[model samples]
Target: MMTKLGPLLLVLLLAGPESSCGDNPRYEKFLRQHYDNPKSSFSGKYCDSIMAKRGLTKPECKEVNTFIHETKNNIKAVCEEGGEPYGNLRRSKEHMKVTTCKLKGGSTRPPCKYKENSSPRYIVIGCENGWPVHYDESQIVTTVDNADLD
Candidate 1:
């Protein structure tokens, strides 16, 4: 589970040392929604909207952008090969190349055909216009999960 940031942090970033009325409740609500689901781009948009409405000066928009960029980099780094293959997936209509990933607690050499008998852990990164239209995996699943061969 993701740990949530508190309203105190939001207020500190926005209003500073002043506790005023008229907008405190709204600010608290916005902070709660944002911290609860920072991964949602729609939530980011909502935050931008709130900032516009409040006419308050806060780094909410900038924070959202930075958060997204950093998270993407972390995901890319998970599959990097000597920092060369950063898993920079690109949006495509068709699936791209299948490069073998270094499996967990396993041999460093490329997975053999016999070893490619199970589902590989992968993260779908590239999104076409904010929607994931395609995916390229390091390996493919041979056995179907919960398969209904009827």
Candidate 2:
């Protein structure tokens, strides 16, 4: 169960000090969070709008990003999912299921292309009020059982 966060764990491990942003009493809040539930229908312009709003523009476009589809409460519960401390952050752990989007095309300007990678993984997230509030860091209190994928 906890082993699922492998890929995401790797990302957190490599994340630099200034990777995420937010002020929700726990983890930094995303500039523009969106619901990426599997059943939802998103317009083709989804990335175009969100990228700008999140300040992911300027210089070069963001190469990769992720969207969680679960509720704030459900996400927070991940802290108790138990794994291992990701970094120096307090009370954080890895969760499962995320939609990762990678920039496509060679251009870094407008109309940035993107490819989606949706899967169940061990995601590193910061939690507050018994829920997850930000990503990129946290601590855990569990051990790995298996490295299965969903």
Candidate 3:
């Protein structure tokens, strides 16, 4: 993470378009550096405020982004969950526990809206320093895996 522009571009090219989040280690590093939850409840308003504070509100707005409260080591271990592959990106089964988030309707401009949906499901994340730093949107396997534990 916090890699130079050249390395970032290289990683993006390898990750492809679908690998929106967690494609760039810099962004992952940014998330780890700025957004780690413990203070407030992980609610919709929390997503809105954090996204804006993290500079994810520029241009249009990030429609989807997940912030995991668990330790980075636990999150990174998800990659080895033996899930299927998603395009060229690495993915895990719908077993890893996570709190998912999406922007609510009418969230188009500044002061974006977000709705927090916490559940256990297959998640894709990028790792740095042997820790999962960013959640990848392209690699989400499923949301309907009710068997996932809370």
Candidate 4:
């Protein structure tokens, strides 16, 4: 079942300062564009619908983008607790579900095309004012020891 953003979720996403860790405009944008907690099921055309629904295809198709599937709180915990800081980017301590979107054949035209890859990997988020501002990167989680995955 595809969960469209609306109703109570809209209020939560568009909440005021009284909300929890995600209280800023950048955090809202990040949630709208990248964070998909109850994400859509993966398919060959996943990127096209998902990105359009998330508003990433608006001012021209984004070259590449990644969607993270995890609770907002868990994503924040990466920065607050076990995350390692590398300047403005912080790497998540746990491997997460993510789908990366890339432009197909280098096309930038309307009805933008994309290819997707879904896997377990560690993600990085840009932190600003203690909120996740944007997705920075994700590295494949090697099959090493759990504690040594980093």
Best by TM-score: 4
lDDT against the true structure, per candidate, is 0.30, 0.54, 0.58, 0.76
Tens digits of lDDT, candidate 3, 19-134: 35545566567455334544345355777777776667778677877655544444455545553445434456545555555777765676678777666566665544434455
* Candidate 2, 15-133: lDDT as tens digits: 74334434453354442443344424557555555555566666667777777666544555556655344553333245455666668887877556667766656666654653455
lDDT tens readout by residue for model 4, 62-112:
888988888777777776785777456877777888888888876676778
Q: Give one clash count per candidate, in the order shown.
A: 0, 8, 1, 0
Candidate 2 at 43: error in angstroms?
A: 4.2
Q: What are the TM-scores, per candidate, against the unseen true structure?
A: 0.17, 0.52, 0.54, 0.74
In candidate 1, the residue pairs with backbone N, CA or C atoms under 3 Å apart (3 or more residues apart, or in different chains) clash, namely none
Per-residue lDDT of 22-138 in model 1, one digit per residue for the tens?
344543443332222223334434333433343322322222111111222233333333122223553222222222212233332322111111122333333323222233343
Q: How much lDDT does candidate 3 score?
A: 0.58
Error of 3 at 56 (Å): 1.5
Show where candidate 1 strays beyond 4 Å.
1-87, 90-116, 138-150
In model 2, what lDDT does residue 138 have?
Answer: 26
Sorting all predicted structures by TM-score, with the top scorer first, yields 4, 3, 2, 1
- Which is better, 1 or 2, measured by lDDT? 2
Which candidate leads in lDDT? Answer: 4
In candidate 4, what residue range of length 10 has the lowest lDDT sum?
A: 137-146
lDDT of 4 at 116: 86
lDDT of 4: 0.76
